[model samples]
Target: MSNLLSTPYLDRYTVNLTKKIAQNPDNYRAYEREPVTNRVLVSLLKKIQNSPLLVGEAGVGKTAIVEDLARQLLASNDKLLANKSIIQISLANLMQTSDGESFAYKFQQILNELMANKDTMIAFIDEIHQIVGTGADNQGSALDAGNIIKPALSRDDLQIIGATTTKEFHQYIAQDGALMRRFDLVEVPELSFNQTANILKKVSSQLGGEITVSQEVQDQIMTLSQRYITDRFFPEKAIMLLDGAISQAKLNQRLAVTTEDVADIIHADYHVPKYVINQTTDERLANLSQRIKERIIGQDHPLDKLTMKIINREAGLTDSSKPASFLFLGPTGVGKTETAKQLGILLFGEETNFIRFDMSEFKFASSSFERFKDKLTTEVRHTPYAVLLLDEIEKADPEVMDLLLQVLDDGRLTDAYGRVVNFKDLIIIMTTNSGAKAIQNHHAKSDYIKNDQKRQENFEEQLEIALQGDGYRPEFLARIGAMIIFDVLTLADIEKIVALKLKTLDEKAREQGFHIIFEPSEVLQYLPSFEYGYEYVEGQKVVSSSIAKYIADVGYRPSRGVRPIDDTIDVYIGDPVAQAIIAKRAGQLEDFNAFIFRALGNPPSLTSPYGEWQTVISRTKEGNYEVI
Candidate 1:
């Protein structure tokens, strides 16, 4: 449709026209316009011409609907637009300060003139909610429109259209019973997705910008805005975006808005609420073969064949929506935690995709089942995918496995909170030291026996060496789609793990503006560290200070890696000697050696001084050290 430009000049209309100009189409603006499907609303407005008024959600298109109806009426009549026509009045704006004849007299005078030719004009009184305060001075407490507007309507000439945004419109224009019956109530829906997009487009055109958004961008905007932006008067916001885009483009001397420009515009509108979508999730099953080789190490065929079967069925290579859960019965430091994390990162796009639960904390299956059920549901709704980690499943009050029968069979569980968690969308990974060996060694040998009757009867003496251990029920163990046994880490594996852990810490430090590096990691990479380095004492895994203590003892390795001071094992105090010369030492062999030597001791971990504030550490050889 072409622009509606017939609205001519009127001294009194100057401000209204200016408002329209400000809101009209321009580049870098939100689109606004008459929607194509307002037919019912148009008829409602015409019917109100001889009657009362209608009010609804403030700032929604009540007035706009009336305006469009007026336009349509003029078009149909063909001469109404050119002749003595429709007039709208705001009583508050018209009341003069002069009290000689009273404001009511002036209001009545204007109304008298508006309906002078009663058979030809339509006057709409707006802001009708102001009726309560008007009658305080005594010429009575009401500006009853029934008597005032009846002159024209009785002769089939007096017609009025009243619009208001407050519920109290009924109080202001009191014609009561018969009068209130005359007007038809009409309502308008908030702008739809397409309407909002069009509004932005038109506003951009008005601003004289050539940029336009694609459907994809509009889709994203609508999806996000629906959840954040309140549905209200959007004209101001529309102009702000346009002005913002124009200002940004002028500053950069750019002719068109790129996607980056649009993002900046939107960011300005809402900064804190917009979340950044991190790494993308690549399907774990797709690359399960390779990850198993790297992370599980030595367990190739068992991992591959098992992973393939589970992956195929869930990937719709089968006809079911259900995903199977698996319990890995193996020794500690194997790859249970690492595998789950890897798969989460693989399937959900980040290494932290796994939601881990330490079974030691869950003494009863009922409570673990309850807490886990809520966390999983809420997390999945906000985040597309997750890997549920049941660390050391056997340690969880062995009866907890009793609860698993239902979950394993149906891939779901109803928690105490009454929330039904659907596990079909999740891939549950549980690790257990439940085999007949590990449990027997610990005092928890009785935890695995499924039978209450057989468990109490001389169970201690009756069990054979293998039967004495903690093993899961055959049916319970079978639910896991795949089982990758984690071998006790060889000393070599521990060394590799420690080295990797240190390397990760260094990277983190560098990102925080620390220039230190750990060269001693390679020196400590001897075999057997993985084999005997870590041990499960009671329920806790303890890897003494050799790696952790050495880092802590070193004290001041530029204060980059050794932050945690738990158990005096992981890290230690700072080296005063190294701290004094750290700012001075650079480039020489002694400088590097002195720094490494100082960081050999365990150091106490310090909390981030400011909860939210963080230091940014960028690294470059040229910037950090003159000698390196």
Candidate 2:
């Protein structure tokens, strides 16, 4: 090893590759990347242009190919490379001098040694882009490192192998036509999935201890890293995952590595939930519709369609590249956004996996569109398996809508920085009020309940016409998996929503050490029913009005959907209950265990309907009423 670096100038600023290979032979032997290694070797064998510039993305085995070439040279019968010694020149050490002249002198000495033994030595420079204009001065002498080496390279006096990333190669080396043309370019691409898995298997075998990785675990590492770890390329990312999982197993003093070990590493590094990483596809999506329905109150028709489309995509019955995209058409404050949230929770195991963008914020200008594109690409790149909800999408600028065409079509969008963000794992839901007035009009018809199927079909046709009038392109509509129409909430649905909200309120109260009970569990039913219009009888027909219309007439506004119900609960129930609890605490009512919420009126009967009702909250032991 010392003899290989025996030259004073070479020993001062370079590493001898042949010696490192001899010391740890297995590191260079396990997976040689034979195709790339042969490319580098064949280029090095050329007489006119013997140097090869290896350009690839990071972690794609550019440096490994060079090391493997050296290893092959040591045992080869090819006369050109058999006597060659590959030395890596360290640019950092060479540029340690004070000025350009001193640096140029040191580099010239290293070049002199290479020139004297040009037939027996080959130079390897990693991150070789740094060599271009490295030591250029304020004066116009082109005596920099790259310029000094060009003559020897062109004259075939020095055989060199240079490696750099694709970005750096274009940014720096490609600028100098004279220097760039001297070396043959060997473009190295990332390895395929099967290639990466084979490499992991070989590397795991080299572990050779009680700590073992099953073939199943290796397959998972490759698949998950390829899917979730999008910022990097394989087999490097896969190797890192394998190493981290093995380290985890060793820390726990376990003899065998499991899939959970790999999942934990992914969860920690990428923020993907452990359940998502650990579970199989079918397991994660098991009972998916039922799980969503548990949180979302109504809109079963749209939910059913959404569930089926997702299942179809997962089963490969549809285009698997793009996400399962949908346009949720309806009035605001319905279950559209809530359904998206529920899907996020049910599919990804948490609420944070739901990403939302209020498109109204991007409606003004091109600058806003750029901001939206940046944020959208970055978030999707980080969390590929999220439910992306674009609320009020009809309000966005035309440019922003244009941007989504590619995302819906290809399941990817390259950002301002030229990164292709993958949306294949996302569930894209866009909500709009473009046809809200039509839906509300249909719901208000006299026979809406009895003829719902026909009414819904008519409503959909009206909605497509309205969307087309609003300038929504036909191609965009065609790309969506479904344009699900969320219907106006019925009185029964609002009642269920109120109950769900009250359950949440009760949980909150219990968390603070007190319980809340809705007496009879139907005490809040009066909120959904109201009295307004007078009834009449005309010509043997009875004229009647519904509770839904009465509520709407009295400004309860059921047409606006569940938001009014939420506001009603917060004002009539939540605020009063909170105030009563505070007042009880102020009065030193610590012994009270529960608060009873009930209506202070006669329960409605056919003979005594239309009576006024008041909601009241009472502490159990205090027996004091807080009335509303």
For lDDT, the strongest prediction is: 2
For all candidates in order, the CA lDDT equals 0.47, 0.78
Cα error of candidate 2 at position 339, Å: 1.4
Local accuracy of candidate 2 as per-residue lDDT tens digits, 1-628? 2334337888778998987897776678627388888888889878777799999999988888888788887888987678578999988888786545378889989998988777678899999998887877779878888998998888888888999999999998999988999989999999888888888989886762668899898988988899788767877899889999999999888988888888889888877877687677799778888877777767876788889888888777988778888999888777898898888988888888999999989988757778888999998877777899999888888888888988888888887788777888899999998988887777677774627787667767778989989978888888888998887887667666666777787899888877776634232322222222222223332222332222222224555666776566676667766776787778845456566554444334588565453455545544442322
Tens-place lDDT digits, model 1, residues 477-530: 556666654444333444344445545555644454443333434322321232
Off by over 4 Å in 1: 1-60, 69-74, 78-84, 91-105, 125-159, 164-182, 195-228, 233-251, 272-520, 523-571, 575-590, 597-628
Query: Which candidate comes out best when scored by TM-score?
Result: 2
Error of 1 at 83 (Å): 3.3
